[model samples]
Target: MGSLWSQFSTPNPMFTEDDVAPQDSKVFRITGGYSGIGFELAKMLYRKKGRVYIAGRSDQKGQQGIKDIQHSASAEAFKPKEAKLHVLWNNVGVCQPPVGSASKQVIELQLATNCLGPFLFIRYQLLDHAH
Candidate 1:
């Protein structure tokens, strides 16, 4: 078996502004973006003038985060065109048994939320709106 440290491997290096060209009104979607690293990442993209759409199953929390970012942007005098909601963050996560329980019956809950939801969101929402 692999060492336990492998489970906690460091993430890939962060990209600098110089490394990545600034997007022109690209839709940025993040799931589970209401809190934690996803929220912080959305904020960073917003500050960099990207349209950020943070998505969460909880509407209250998701809207709150959006308002907080908008408030911060207004305080910083960033124009709406410069920073707006474009991408939808699919940050939601869940865990279930490999096979669903006889009563609970949630075979695809985790996959649908973590995988298919984001895929469909990108394909449907972003693609439909893309120029």
Candidate 2:
């Protein structure tokens, strides 16, 4: 038997817009993707023809995950969308002391990356960029 990691090392599968087309009634999720339950959830959604976007905190990892999905789709004889799958995952957060970092005195890194970064991404990227 293959190691558990090896067994799960396979990337999530992707489907074409036609095969897994978004019908204007799909839901999107964020955070906790690229591993664990989140990965499985994304896989299932993709398989069901939902417009699934995997968001996280690492660009390289996010891109790699997208590649894995494409590879899986190709291997499975499906035409995955080359540009349809959008990735909102990014690490704009900064390190700060535990608890109430946004209160009183805020660490610039923590505030900018953690609080403001995501806020901007959501407002500009997700909301404004919605198609």
Candidate 3:
């Protein structure tokens, strides 16, 4: 619990951008990787040669994040193949519309987006990336 709280704090003591280096041939899929901490982490991965996949619901925001990473990565010396950004369109909404206000389809979509998406991403994506 304490550790979890620290993650929300400023200058979170989790993973730092400097902790990992260019992976070159590796692919990374960050579930909420299009903004905030995810965006910053993606930048770090980009610098380290990791092929980053900014997985999020907002296509526009995710593309913008990719552009930001590309712009920063361009300034650094990197190989051609490592320059492209891959985006996985995974919707991850926190909640559905209040109670009976939403249709069954909407409720299901919300549940899938918020819960199933992250779970599948973590289970399958991480397993796939395992060496």
Model 3, position 5: C-alpha lDDT score: 77
* Model with the higher TM-score, candidate 1 or 2: 1
Query: What stretches of model 3 exceed 4 Å from their correct place?
Result: 1-15, 75-104, 108-111, 119-131
- Score each candidate by Cα lDDT: 0.65, 0.57, 0.66
Q: Cα deviation of 125 in candidate 2 (Å)?
A: 1.1
What is the TM-score of each predicted model, taking all chains together?
Answer: 0.53, 0.42, 0.53
Q: Per-residue lDDT tens digits of candidate 1, residues 1-131?
A: 35576668855557753466555466576877768888887776777666676766689998888877776653233344423455555666666735753223443667666677678777876666665
lDDT of 3: 0.66
Residue 117 of candidate 1: its Cα lDDT? 69
Look at candidate 1 and tell me the lDDT of residue 93.
66
Order of candidates by lDDT, top first?
3, 1, 2
Instruction: Tell me the tens digit of each residue's lDDT in model 2 across 1-131.
Output: 45577677865546543465442335445454566666666665555555566777678877776676555543232333333434444433446556655533454556756677678678876676555
Q: State in Å the error of residue 106, model 1.
A: 3.9
lDDT of 3 by residue, 13-101 (tens): 57666777557767566767778777887788778877777777689998888888888885343343433335443434556465555
Give the poorly placed runs of model 1, Cα more than 4 Å off. 1-27, 71-89, 95-105, 128-131
